[model samples]
Target: MTIQTVTTTPYNDQKPGTSGLRKSVKHFKKPDYLQTFVQAIFNTVQGIEGSTLILGGDGRYFNREAIQIILRMAAAAGFGRVILGQSGILSTPAASHLIRQYQAIGGIILSASHNAGGPEGDFGIKFNISNGGPAPEQLTEAIYEASKGIHSYQIAPIQPIPLDKLGTYELHGMPIEIIDSVTDYMALMESLFDFDKIAALLQADHFKMRFDAMHAVTGPYAHRILEERLGAPKGTVMHGQPLANFGGGHPDPNQAHAKELMALLFARKSEFDFGAASDGDGDRNMILGKQFFVTPSDSLAVLAANATLIPGYRNGIAGIARSMPTSQAPDRVAIKLGLPYFETPTGWKFFGNLLDAGRITLCGEESFGTSSSHVREKDGLWAVLFWLNLLAEKQDSVENIVRKHWAEYGRNYYSRHDYEEIDLKAANELIAALLDKLPSLTGQTFGALTVGSADNFAYTDPVDGSVSQNQGIRILFTDGSRIIFRLSGTGTQGATLRVYLEKYEADTNKHDQDVQEALADLLTIAEQVAQIQAFTGREAADVIT
Candidate 1:
């Protein structure tokens, strides 16, 4: 096969966020758009020539085509070998494990995360480094720089390799190996969790749990682990097929998107003892109980407080880390356990250094993302399994366990309000105005809350000594209530302004109030301070979680 160097023009809009470059499928289908970006990654990653690469996607509409293109490009780029998941199916966490297990130079993950997927929907490409984590800011910046100046992309002149079967094939001098996507990941999970114990719990006549895959990538993983290996009933995993358009529904596993699952779990007489759901790429999760919801922040806290019950963490953890937007519940756990804690800006990449340096054993974000030193990327099924282990050991209802945790650690009432697809200019202006007002907000009182501090958040990574500034705006009150404003980068459309509200309550009697009702005053304070309605022209947030 001849190696073809096709000349191409660079696109300046390929700048990646913390998640990687995401755009509409139409934009990616443009001539040379995907090629330019892929070549830029190949050029930016040093020593890629004659090195290995792992490749796969979430089985979205464009997943297979993207895999074919990347495969040919890898062969032409002189890669020694390429490992692919069968039928181009791999969850974000699975891809991360493949990268680390093979010690490949890097892996390319094709997913829009929780976003919708279709011919007209969004598509994305994320490059994970040798550490099995998102590329750090420095490396992503280099890729962006290279993309801006790319002139050509290399590809082998060959037919598309069959990805349906598990086998080895040759492309030019590169060997392409297609492997079962779930086997290794299942083995890793089995190693971390007590499968036998969890199986017993799953098979118990009195206990029933449901795992909704949201018709995305986790269907196979959940089916294999929860149903096949653990002996749960056949229909225990809902939406258990990976659909190209995610069944024409948003794959986000929040209260809004996973409405069916939420309704079933929150029913007046719910049948299930435990409930969980995972997002598009299977990196994010939503945990629910009979007539109860466990906030991602509280879930992290509960897991950490009872982590030793699980075999993987039986020896105990080294430390804890959470995104700045995540509530301080886990921080309380870190304190009670005397383990060190660190808070960084949003993005899994920020936790990579900590996990690799043995500084943190568990890390998570408020946006339904959580994991540990087990895998660099967040693993949704893993989070579900962790909860299962806790359930089996504690032999308590999910609500009771959470309530006890709250009674011990004090409940941190937390919610995230997302105003998605707002005008880009308006969102930028709102943040600018917020920044201008930060200096004057401190010591001011809105309602019964007095501002303790107000500033744009910044962080310095202790492991690598790198600084990231302008992360978000934080308005912390003297009463331990907080309102945070940050523009989300994961969306492909117009900007998404995310407002985070948190309040700490030490009284167990006060924990039963509705989340929104508990923070009604703070919500008013947020609108008053940020002027969200006037700025974004939205009377209420589009989604609240």
Candidate 2:
């Protein structure tokens, strides 16, 4: 095999956000686009020669092609071995685990998580460090800098390697192993969760659960774990197949995207006792009961409070952490448990340090992401299994568990409104205007709510001491209500302005109120302060969750 160094030019728009470089598939298909970015990674990250690397994706369109390109690049870049997932399928969390379990140098994951997929849809790529976490800010920045000035990329000139079989193959003298995507991940999950207990709950005649993989990467994992291993009925896992275009449905595990699952769970006298869904890359999860929805925040809080019931956490957890935009319900749990708690920025990478240092046992984000020290990235199936173990041990309905939790720890009414695909300039202007007004907004009163403080969110990593600034703008009210504003880069076109509204209700009587209705005052105040409609011409949020 001959190693070739192809000349290339830098693409100016290659900077990655917290989720990595996501863009339209057409953009990535540009000549030398993907090659340039992959080469930038190999060039920037040191110690590539003769090191092991992991590679796979969610089996979306172009996933196979991307894997082929990266494999060839890795062989030419002097990697000794590459662990490739069968049929180019690997969920985000599973990839993280593979990186750590194998002690590889790092891994390159191809996914535009929760985004639409297809030739016309989105595509993305991100490098995870040896710690099995998203490359931290410093490394990502370095990759971006390298992408800007790269003039050539190295690749092994070879035919594509077959990825359907679970066996080893040679690619330009480097050993490439096509491994079963679910076995290692399943083993890890079984270790942390009481699968036997969960299996009983799943097999019980009185209880029925539905897990929607949304035709994304979690289908096989769910099938292998829930049906084949745990003995759930055959049809328990819906959309349990990895499709290139996600079966023409948006694969986000949210109320808006997982419509079929939500409809089934919300139906009158719902057939299923519990319902769960995972996103495209299987890192985010949405949990529901019979006509009951569990917010990601509440899910974290409930799980943390009852973690000792699970086999893995029987000895108790080290601590708890949540994203700054996440509700404070889990923080309250941490306080009650007398465990350390941390509030970091939105990315799961922020939790990596704490998890690595053993400062936090569990961490979550309001974006339907939750995970523990078991993996660096959020694990959707793991969250589902955690809930399953909790349900099996408690021998109670999901609604009761959450209601009881609310009664004990109080309820945090929270909602996030997203104005997606809006004019980029307008969204930037809106956030810029808010940043300028943050200083004066303090002590101001708006519609019976008095602002106690306001500022752009920032954080200093306790473990690494690295600083991340301008995370988001937040307004805190004296009544324990808050409205946060941030620009999301997960979209392919335009900008997505996300406004998070939260209010703490200690009165148990108000716990039954509808989430949007409970936060109505905060909603009005958020719009009044941000002037979202005026700035972006959005009458209402494109999606609310």
Candidate 3:
């Protein structure tokens, strides 16, 4: 088994974002594109030689090809073993779990994560460290720097091994194990949640829930957990099959992308009692009740408030954490529970240190991400099951649970407006102008709302003491209303500007109003603060969630 070193030129644009290196499939198809990045990751990671690496993907287009190439590279790079998922399928959260469960040195995941798939769509590669979390900023920066200067990559001269097999084999002196992707993940979920209790809830004749996989990676996960194990009806999991192109639909689980589920759940009278959807890699979730949409911010608060009801968190949570852009609803819950809470930047990697240090047990983001200390990455199905566990234990409707929460701690009328595919420089200029005026605009007024404070968000890691500045620009009103603006780091095209609007309403009666109507004043104020329309040339937000 001879190793071959193929000389190649470097690509300057292989820098990683909040998660990993993402680009269009065509861009990745360029000569030595994926190879160069893989080599860079191999060269940058600390003490990878003779280590085990778990490898898989989200079942997107070119996933199998990429898996084969990575296996060959791992063999030549002197890895002791490579654990590949059957059919090259492993959702993001599952990969994290496997990396921890097997005690592997690290892992590689191929996914674009809620982006479209296929030849024309997006593809991504994320590297996780020994702790089973996304690589930290310093490590990602090292990978990017190595990518810029890489000249060659090594690969074993061997034919592709069959990924469908279920046993271990030897390839180029490296042990390759292909295992069922769903089995271990299902087992992990069963341990964290009350399987017997959830089964009883699903068996109830009046209880009905819809789990929409969006034809992405969560399809098999949902089918196994919700239908087979829980004894729900066979048809409970909709779109419950992984497709390379995600059935030509965007895999994001939002009102805009998951129109069918949202429409059914938002109807005047929905047949189902609960509905849920997950993103492409199964890390992000959208939860809905009949005629109700629970904002992700509110969902985190509800989970924190009811943590003691579930088996896994019965003893109570240590603390909580949320991204800066996420609403302050969780803060209220944390205050009531007398638990410490930390606000980090927009990336999940920021929560790794907190979780590992045992400073926090639950962490989430406004981008439909929620998870506990179960694994480093967010788990979509886990959130859904947690919601189900709460619903069953209380014997209450989702709407009533949310209303009760609001009655206790007040409601946060929250919405995120996304401006997609706009000019990058124009968006930056808008931000630059905001930064220039942030200090002077504190006392100014936007309509009846008086600005109390404003600043660019920053964070000092409590565990490591590292500081991250310029996270986002946020303006707070006197009455606890907020408007936040930030450019997205995950898009494949032009800049994507996300405007987050939030208004705290203490009156429970006011919670029944439409979302846009509830935040109308903040919406207008956000545009006025950022000059969104004038700079981006767009009238309405592409997606509001």
Candidate 4:
């Protein structure tokens, strides 16, 4: 094989957002676009030679093509070994586990993470460090700086390597080990969960579960673990096949995107005991029971409350952490357990340092991200199994479990309203006006609530002592209500303004009210405070979750 450096110019828009460098597939298809970003990653790491590089993706449209390019580049970059996933399929969580399990120097995960996918849809790539977590803000900034001044990229002149075969293959003298995508991840789950108890529950005649993989990367994982190993009846897992286009639908597991499984669970007198769905990369999960939709915040609370009942958590957890915008339910649980609780800024990357230092055993976010110390990235299937393990041990209905939790810990009525595709200038202006007023609003009143504290969010990493400022703007009311405002960092088009609303209710009877109605007061105050409709010229939020 001959190594060659190809000349290319830098693209100013290659900077990564909340997750990674995501753009329209057409944008990535521009001359040397993907190569440019990959080369930037190479330059930032600066130690690719003699290091093991793991590569895989969510089996999206450009997955295999990207893998081939990266493989040739890795060879030319002088990596000693490259671990490949069979058929170029590996969920985000699986890739994280592989990075740590194999002690690979780092990894390249090709995923847009819940974004729509196709030739006309979104595409993305993020590099994770050896700790099996997304690159921290420092590294991400370094990559962005590198992407700006790149002049050339290196690659080996070599033939294409077969991606579907499971064996060792040589490409440009670099050994590529193509392995099963599900086995190692499943092994990690087996160690943490009581498989025998879950198997017995699934074997019961009356217990029924519907797992929607959404035609993405979790198909094989859910099928093998839920059906083959746990004795679930055939066809319990829906969309159990990985499709490049995700079967022509956006593979997000939200109610609007994953309507098939949601319909079955919402149907009158639905017989299914539980229903769960995972996003394109299999890291975000939405869980439902009968007609009940469990919000991500409540789901984390229930899991923490019932930790000891699940075999994996039999030994108990140390502490808990959650994104600042997340509900205060976990704090209630942590308080009950007398464990330390932390609230950090948005993004799963913030939880990695805490999880590693053993300061927190479980961490979650309002964006349907939940996981423990078992893996750096959130695991959708892992959360599902943890719920199942609790259910199997408790022998209670999902409704009962949630009602019981609220009865003990009170309920946090939480909702996030997102204004999508707003003009970038207008959105930034809205936030700027709010930031300017944050200091004066300390004692101001909105509707009958007095402001206790109002400021933009910031955090200092406890383990690494790194600081991140200006994360989001938040207002706390004297009545224990909260309203948060921030622009989302995960979209490709115009800005997405997210307004999070929450109010705590300790009365059990109050928990029965509609979530929107229960939060109506806070919602109104938030709009009044931000003049949302006035600034964005929108009557209502684009999406409420």
RMSDs, each prediction? Answer: 0.7, 0.7, 0.9, 1.1
lDDT of 1 at 42: 91
Give the alpha carbon lDDT tens digit for every residue of 48-128 in model 4: 788998889998888888899999888888899999888998899999999999999889999988888889888889998
Clashing pairs in 2: none
* Count of backbone clashes, every candidate in sequence: 0, 0, 0, 0
Candidate 2, run of 10 with poorest lDDT: 157-166
Give the candidates in order of lDDT, highest first: 2, 1, 3, 4
How high is each candidate's TM-score? 0.99, 0.99, 0.99, 0.98
Candidates in order have lDDT scores of 0.94, 0.94, 0.93, 0.90
lDDT of 2 by residue, 1-545 (tens): 68999999899889998989999999999999999999899999999999999999998899998898999999999998999899999999999999999999999999999999998999999999999999999999999999999899999986779889889999899999999999999999989999999999999999998999999999999999999999999999999999999999999999999899999999997888999999999999999999999999999999999999998899999999999999999999999999999999999999999999999999999999999999999999999999999999999999999999999999999999999999999999999888889999999988788999998999999998999999999999999899999998688889999999999988899899988998988888888888899999998999999
Error of 3 at 34 (Å): 0.4
Put down candidate 3 lDDT per residue, 68-160, tens digits, no spaces: 899999999989999988899999999999999999999999999999999999999999998889999999999999999999999998678
Clashing pairs for predicted structure model 4, backbone only: none
Worst 10 residues of 3 by lDDT: 262-271
Which stretches of model 4 miss by more than 4 angstroms? none
Regions of model 2 farther than 4 Å from truth: none
